[model samples]
Each structure stands twice: as C-alpha cells, then as structure tokens.
Target: MDPILDDHLHLDPVKGRGVEAAEEFADHGGTHLLVLNKPSWHYDVAVEAGDDFRVAYDHTLDVVADSTEVLPGRAWPVLGVHPALVSQLVERGYDPEDARDLMCAGLDVAAEYVEEGRALALKSGRPHYDVSEAVWAASNEVMRHAFALGADLGCAVQLHAEGSEDFTEVADWAEEAGMARERVVKHYSTGGVVGPTPSVLADKDELERVVERDVPFMMETDFIDDPDRPGAVLGPKTVPRRTRWLREEGYDEALERAHVETPRLVYGIDTLGTLA
Candidate 1:
C-alpha cells in the first residue's frame, strides 16, 4: 500500500494489547498515526511511547510539556476537550458562566488542533442546546480565542454533530463568528445526522463543497475495526469501507499525499496508541 499515512488510528488496550497493535501497524508500512491522549488507558500508552507516535490530548496541559520535550519542532501537543466534560461540570452544579470559561481555558491550554463533539451520556437524548449548550458556547469562544492568538494553530475542531441540518447550523454559526472559513473542518459523517453513510455525503454534494472550500475534512477509524486484530468496536471491516468510499468521492489519498497536496487535510485514530 506504499506506506500509507493514516490520519487517525485508535489502539485498544488489554494490558499490553493496544500499543502492541500500534507497533504491529507501524511494522506493516503505516507511516504515522494520530493517537488521542484521553482516558487513563491512553495516557499510560502516550507516556510509554514517547515520540514513536503523535499524541492528541483529550483534556490535559501536561501533554504540552511532553510534546515540547519529545517531539520538539513538531506541533507536539494536540488538544480536544470532551463535550461530555462540559456536561459533567453542569451536573456538578457549576455555574454556566464558570463552566464555559473553564472549558475555554482547557482548549487554550492544549492548543487543541481538533475538537470532538461526541455525545456525553447525559446529553445524548436531550436537546442539543440543553444537552451541550455549554460545549457549543465554549467551542465558539475558543474559536475566537484561537483567532485572537494570531497563530495559525492549525487546529481542526471535530464535531460529532450528527447530520446535515445541525452541521449547516454549526457551520453557519462559525462563519458568522468570523472563524476563518478556510480553517473550519468538519469531522465524520457529512449527511443525515450522526454517522451518515459515504453515499449520503457524496450523493448530496457535501464532499464537493468541502473540497471546493478546502476545508480540512477527515474521517476517523475509531477502534471498532482493528486491522491487526479483530473484535474492536469498529475496525478494518468498517472503517476501510468508509475510506474507500471517501476516496471514490475524491478525497485525497493518505496523509502524506494530503500533506503535500492538501496540507489542511488531517487524520486521527481515537484509541490507545498515537499516530506518528
């Protein structure tokens, strides 16, 4: 496969399970993987791997230090705050204003290159604004903050926004917020709400829109389909099918080609090991 560069790769852990899976992938011509540094499991793996892979911290500042010390010249620390965390704060009785500020600060601390808008258990069935209003608000604030920082932080916020309707609203709101149109990138599923099929995205012209606008769109292989091993939530059988479909829709091929051709394109794996 010509040493394909996977933008996202998630590792599963059972003692030495996850990192071993990553090592196997590396051995098999995988160029780099983006590891989401979240949960106790991932933290343990990142601290262990050092620079062997790229790390994206879910909600921590210490990763900045690790990236500085380990990866140095690269954008070592990548950050993403869990929307669920915001939900947690709300549940804990924190004032909305205080909670929003704290979430904004977390985004600032890690210089998060991406944002994951996945559902928190409590916020899942509730109204979008009520369930994740604080998250959405904080996300908007961080967008402004990133612009004010005057650094092209090269961060791409990944919203698990479900479908086209919410996506349009989010994109429209971000545009109104003056977020650089070129910088805004949508995460997985481009149509119908939540995990839309590739056919849905391409059939509706969403992919063309993203390409024409040059938004850094990416899809993740979130630990469900493990190539090295099976039994994941979504592994090779699932993720690669989507990747092939996206390629058919004219998405760039691999991270290396994308880096050279469409530098804005990014990839990640939402699992234990880092993507180099």
Candidate 2:
C-alpha cells in the first residue's frame, strides 16, 4: 500500500466519531493525516480572548495523541482559529475589532503549540461566504496574523477561505509574512487551484485532473467526523479509496507524488514517516 494521507480532517470525541473514524481510514489504506481543530464554537468555546482557543486546541491535541496511539504516529495536529469564528464572535456580542483581535490572539496560542512541537501547522482564513465589508476586512486581518505566526514558527499555514482557482492576495500576504508561498496550502482545493499549493478534495475526477500536473499537491477527505452528518465534507475512507482507484488506473508516479513526495515537502514530514 502507498502512503495515503488526508491533508485535512477533524475529530470530535464529544460530538463526532473521533478516533473511531481513524480506524475506518486506516482500514481503507490511509496511512497518515493532518488533523485540524474544528471551529472554536464546535468545542463550546466563546472567545473573549486568545486563551479561549486553548480549550479547543487542547482537545484537538488530545484527539491527535489518541488517534496516533492507535495508528502509531499517523496523525499530526494543526491548531488555529477558523475563519467562521470571527462572525460567530461578532454574533455572540463581540465588537468587530475585538473579535478580530481575539482571533489573532487565538492564532498566537496555536503558534505556541507549533513552536513546542505539539502541532505542525496553523489554520486560518477569511470566511468563504458573503459578509459585511468590515467583517470581511477583519477576517483578512486575522488571516494575516496567522501567516505571520507561520513565518515565525517556520511552519505551514492551512487556509480555509472562499473557493477560487486563484489566491494572489493570499500569496502576497504569505510572502509579506516571510512564509514561503508554497507553505500556505489551500484546503478543500478544487483539484487544480492556482497560487497556494493545493490540498485537493479526494474526488476521483479531481485527483485524476491534478495528478498529471505533477506539482506539489496532496489529497484530503476533509472529514468532519460528525456523527450527525455521517460523511459531511468527505468521509474518513474517501482519500484512501480514491487513491486505490487512482492506482488501479495506472497513476503510480503521480500517486507517489501526492501520497509521499508532496506531503514530505509541504509539511516537512515524510510519508507516514516513522509514524507507520
């Protein structure tokens, strides 16, 4: 089996399948994962300050440890303030500026985890939907803060923003923050997005289209592991399942790039590394 990896996933021991979901992915041939924290609200955290994010980040780290215990270092954690948290903070009574500041503070906490080696990446981005201009501006500010943290830590920043083929501004921000543009990955990528390196969704058609490019890319299930939604975003097994189909279709070289090579380059971790 190849070193299949899901670039973005979330586990909720409280509200989702959590570690059990890791078993499913492993059963289907997935060898590793880049597991990110769900939104702050998902953990019942109301952000009054950056420290509020720790409640969620700690849980995510715990989940990572537990999943790794089962999969033997197959899981690494990415901690951050989700883009939607800005609005959630606002709706929950935070002034816009306060909400933005709190989000930045949240990223600071996440960066500490990365510096301490408890996590490998920081996640941040503007909301993907329409919003008031002020809110949008604030979200961008928080994202910039995340890039700065990534630069300081020399770690990757996983971005979750509106879907687009281009991310020129995001590249500019990453460069300004002293983070390599390639280190900024676009989560939920549409197979062939431009600018940041893509973590393309593990769709058969999408993977097939991007594999031929032979660029730095990885495939992901983006599995939320929410029992309520069952397979929201994508399921735990999707990446491995799609990878198997791709292999049978004779994409060995490209699959190696996606499965092993790209992950090593982008995350500074070898394919399943010592994890497997």
Candidate 3:
C-alpha cells in the first residue's frame, strides 16, 4: 500500500513545541498534512514544509486571499458561518433580530474582522456548523440564501452534527442547494452527548450508510495530546492506535482497496503536529 496521509497536524517551534513534533512526523514519512490557520504562528513550519502542506481556512475570502499570496499552492478553506459563535452573539446582548439581519447581510463585516484579526487562522480554515439548530431555525428560503453565498465562494462547509437529525438535516440542505455531496465535508467524531457515535472506524452497517449516501465526507480523528494527562482522546496513543481502530473496524484494508480499485475515495485527518 501507499504511504498514509495524516490529515490534521500542527507545528510551532517558537513556543518550544511544534518544531520537534513536525520533525518527528517528517522522519516518520507523513506525506500530506492538514494545518489549520487558527495558530497563525505555526504557518512558518507548514510553509517551510512546501507543497506537501494544505491549509484548512475559515470562512473569509480576504484571509484566504492573503495566505494564498504568501503561500502559493495547496490551500483549501471551507466556507460557512460558525454555528458555535451564534449563541455567543446572542449572549453579548446583540438583539437576536438585529444579529440575524447582520449575518444575512452578506457576511461582509464578519469576514473583514475575521481576516484582519486572524487572517492566517480563518482563511483556508474550517468554520464549524451546528447542524441541529441550523435546520430547526432556518426557513427553506433562508437556508437557500446562506448556502448560495457559501457555494459561490468555492469553499467546503464543514458540518458538526449530534444526532440523526443533524445528519439528515445537512444532507437535505445540500440537496436543496443543488450542491454535490463532494462539496460538503462532514466532520464525524465519536458519538456526542445526544447522537450515536459514527461507525467510521467500526460497524459495517453504519459505514455502509456513509458509502451509500455518496456523501463527500472524510475521516478525521480529532485528538488532543496532553503530557500531564494521557488518553484525553479516549483511544490509544500514536497514529497506530487510530490505524488499528480503522483495521479492526474493517476500514483500513477496505480503504486501501478502494483507493486501488475504485476511483475516488476522499479522506482527511485533523491535527498532525504541535501537541504542545
């Protein structure tokens, strides 16, 4: 089989981290790495690594535009308003009605602020979506308007869903927008407080559902490492642990086979280096 692609990673040496981790990854033959733009300080390490690097940008175009100028190739930023921050906007005493109007006003001001403040982090980065609430609140007309802007920008929208409702809602929204599944990359982690943990690594029945749907989603292991606290991710240590889960769940061999036999089997990883 070919070398494995680690989808997510970090590298920031100035802080006495990232550098060593990145070097270790290089030595370990990790080819492609997904580096988020959030920690702008880490851009150096990712840039120095060259074309093997890809940036996961947030929603703003200016942020991504600046980064693209700085680092020519390998930039993919997903576009969408952050669902998590929606509640925060309300908490800040911004009238809900007014805030909704501001958001609907073309994401111009928000995009500008995001670019100026955290350009490296937001551009070519992922903006998360709250699947359940988005569906529950948005009218079909509102949903179409939002998706039109996102799709026109040529960025994938990363989704976070808790239950079957979340999952189905997203799929329905994509259909409504007339966007291909390939344009939407769903982020599936372990079962949340309310939903069933996705069987990305186990449960053939669940995995089959993903395949059957022809969804344009990728498998990303969202793990955070803490020296003082181990097993924070609820799995074993090292990449091998993830690989083992994939194998045990009949994913590894199958994915490799698909890569060889079938045409396109899209996948991604979250956080590769900089565990500091």
Candidate 4:
C-alpha cells in the first residue's frame, strides 16, 4: 500500500493527545503527519516580544521532533500563529492593536523556523465568519505579513480561514502579498471550496471533485488530538481509511495524486523518507 500523508494535525500536549495519538495514527496506516502548533495559552504568551517567543518556538520544534520517537520518519513539523487567537486575547482584555503586533511577531518566529529547517511550512489565516470585522481585518493583516514572509523564505503558507467555495479572495491576497498562489494552501479545506491552490479535504465526494478538477490537494482529518473529543473534526485514522476506500473504488490514480504525489511536491517528502 502507498503511504498516506495527513497534511494538517495537532500533536501538542495541551489540546492534543501527543505521542499516544501519534502511535494510534501510525497503527491505523497513517505514515506521515504534518504536526501543526496550536495557539494554546503558552503559545499565546510565547508570541510576545523578547526571548520568550524564541524559547516557545524552540520548544515547539522540540515537541514536534519528539513525535518522531513514536512514529519515526512519519512526523514532520508545521509552525505558525493561529489568527483566531486574536479574538480570544481581546476577550481576555488584551488590546486589539497589541494582539495584532504579537501575531506578526509570532509569524516572524515561524518564518525563522522555516528558514532554519525546523519546519516545512507556516500556518496563518483569518478567523471564523462570526468574529468582529475589526478582528477579522487584523487577522487578514497578519495573514498578509505571513504570506510575504513565506514568499521570502520559499515556504508554503497554510491558511486556516472559514470554508468557502470560492478561493479568489485568498488568491488575491497571495498576489497582493507578492506570493505565489501555488504556495498558499487552504487548511481544513472541504468539498465546498475548489481551486488550484493546494488544500486538504475531508470528504471523499469532495475529494473526487477536487481530483476531477486536477487540483493540487491532500487529505486531512484536522485531528486536534483532543482526548475528550477524540477525532473531533475527523478521526486520526480517517485519511488512511479514505485512501483504502478510494483504492477499492478504482480511483487509484486520484489517490496517488492526492495522497502521494501532491504531498511530495508541496512538502518535498521523498517516498524513502516515509515510515515503512
């Protein structure tokens, strides 16, 4: 069987089940996972200026690196600042302006990690639709900065915005930031949204449409690693199961493109580097 890669997932101790989750994913045929850092309280404080953020960023790298002990070459790291946390900070009494500043600073740290080979990509994007326009705008600004930074560092930027059928706005943002549309990935991408930009889809029917369009995409459970909600968005084993289903349905070519080829092209993962 060809190895299945999960493009987006969290494996942190705070909100995720960490190493145990990694073991479970591996047990279920998940070969490689792009472990993203969530905007937990420690991370929020770590994004602040000074040596604190740097230390936090380094710790993030350490945590991701440690996942390899449980899954070997299957673990890869994606570091970034989540934009939704801006609203959380505002609710906690932090000034909006200060929150924006911290977000930008966090992106800078994430870009540095990409440059240092500590991570393969950076994740940042707008919050949900219900957030205040001011918060949304501030998050967009941060995303712009992140796009620019990713462009400069030759890294892909995964966007965590609301699900939208049209990605023209995000493509425009990438263009305005002088970044390549191909380097901009839409995270938590569902069947509803379709485009050329790389994305990770959860639904098989939607995955079929994306493949039919010849879109560059991958599969993800967006597994948050929450023990209480275990497999909240989708189970850790979901992608692998979907891959098997596609194979059975005779969509071998599509599965190969989405599960094997696209990840290698976007994240530069050699087949030999994946877990056996």
lDDT of each: 0.37, 0.86, 0.34, 0.74
Q: What TM-score goes with each of the models?
A: 0.52, 0.96, 0.50, 0.89
The top-ranked prediction according to lDDT is: 2
Error of 3 at 13 (Å): 8.5
Candidate 4 per-residue lDDT, tens place, 177-223, comes to: 77767677788876546442556666777777776776678888787
TM-score for candidate 1, please give it.
0.52
Per-residue lDDT tens digits of candidate 3, residues 14-96? 33233334333334433233333333222332222212123323322333343233221222233233333334445566554
Weakest 10 consecutive residues, lDDT, candidate 4? 42-51
| Native-to-model Cα distance after best TM-score fit, residue 119 in candidate 1, in Å | 24
Pairs with backbone N, CA or C atoms under 3 Å apart (clashes), candidate 2: none
Clashes of each: 26, 0, 20, 0
Q: For each candidate, C-alpha RMSD in Å?
A: 9.6, 1.3, 10.0, 2.4
Clashing pairs in 4: none
Candidate 3 error regions (>4 Å): 1-3, 6-29, 36-81, 101-146, 189-217, 224-240, 244-253, 257-276
In model 4, how many backbone clashes occur?
0
Q: TM-score ranking from best to worst?
A: 2, 4, 1, 3
